[model samples]
Target: MTFSIVGRSDDGKAVGVAVASKFLGVGAAVPAALADVGAVATQSYANLAYRPQALALLGTGVSASAALAGLIAADDGPVSHRQAGIVGMTGPGATFTGADCHDWAGGAAGDGYAAQGNMLAGPSVIAGMEQTWLGSSGALPYRLLAALRAGDQAGGDRRGRQSAALLVVSPGRGYGGTSDVWVDLRVDDHVDPVAELGRLLTMHSLYFESPEPSSLIALTGPVAEEVRALLAAAGFGGEELEEELASWAGVENLEMRVVKGSIDPLVLTHLRAAG
Candidate 1:
């Protein structure tokens, strides 16, 4: 009924999980992570408590294997119905599929990733996820999303899909530099939840990603005049156009691309499109 991948970025600076299921609000129950700690995905009769407990154990410097052992030891319910995947920030990863899990259920783990599924089309589902995670390059969130897409294409949940989620954490990566929740998006119920999740991820990247230094354009000459005209047309009248632009960016949720003294080329393009 569920398929998931938990992983740490190759650089070991990010951790995340991607999951899809024929279950309602799987996002609320499946994935958890803390930057610099570890990531966990609990499914197939998932014990929600495993999430926080696993993070706490990893934060205490335990390896992924040891944390999983602790979870098994503390479980009062039947462990044979449960499935989980884990990946620590700086250690090997692990996955477990219980004896009582639905048919076509199993998991695989490698240096920094764990892919698991239950009630899946076949073992190829988890295999496709693992292959994508290993071969794909870029941000952890993107890679995790790609892995889920690959698994779905390879034949995802045997029962079909309803909900999907993506969560990635990195220190100081959250909005306004407040937390580690770099990307947290979900499709609680959708006919094509994985595809919807991908669309959301792309929007999130554009709205939150910082501009590359080379992509910054100085607000001088024609560019500066064009910006002034846009802001003025938008009813902005502040003496400092930079401040006005910042305010506009905030309203449009583009503050992450805002620079104090220069405009991002992407931002300029966006403004032009709207104008």
Candidate 2:
């Protein structure tokens, strides 16, 4: 069984999902996303084909419900067992839990989001997942993690935790420019997968958080001296490098824009050591 969150970012540049389960390699089994198209999670006696085929359908302007319906119609055993959720590019979402699934199985879907789980402790698992998604107020990854945590708190897999994962994608990162994935994380096997997932989520946020607007960090006049000293201590060189850094400016709150390449390197260093 599993619980998850799939949703779009506020600025709409990103879409993704995060999930955790008491199953082996849940990462490999439960989550999928395509840049700017949509995201899906299939769990509990999953049929992995649901991922790529659904993404293909989503890319062609099909709605989440339609894509899922197509899958069910095409499959000979659609009703035998399993659960799934889909979120389309236009923000519509839908979910299905087969009648043959194990105890405490079902799902929730809505605009810009979807979540699903089967073989859970009770209906509260799905309800807590939905509440966590509705309750979260920050970035996409945080919301997803919150939902997973909520599901766990509400009695997740009656079997206990073993694996977790998060998948995210967005358009034109650097290469293809049409469909560039931004984030994908997984905890394949762990004694406490959700705990590992939270640590990973904290590290993931530093890399993907957007730049803050200039109006919020316009310190000028004498305050510039203090800013220079702080930057120097933090890693930037003296006034010349500070002047160069000033071109991007407001590096404090908007750390992503100023960090090397992207924010992932430093976060990874810390995480690797922690794990």
TM-scores, one per candidate: 0.96, 0.77
lDDT of 1 by residue, 208-271 (tens): 8898998899988898889989987777757898999998888889999999889998888888
Model 2: residues with Cα > 4 Å off, grouped in runs: 10-13, 172-179, 208-210, 214-239, 243-255, 259-275
Off by over 4 Å in 1: none
Highest TM-score model number:
1
> Quick one: RMSD of model 2?
5.8
Model 2: per-residue Cα lDDT over 1-275, one tens digit each: 77777787767667788888878888888788887788888776788998998899999998899998887777666555868888877866888888988887888887778878878888898888887787777767777778888888888888898998988787765222443766677899998888898897676555444434432333354444545554555566465643545443344333443433222233323323433
lDDT of 2: 0.73
Please give the clash total of every predicted structure, in order.
0, 0
- Model 2 / residue 76 / CA error / Å: 3.5
Error in Å for residue 202 of model 2: 1.8
Clashing residue pairs found in predicted model 2: none
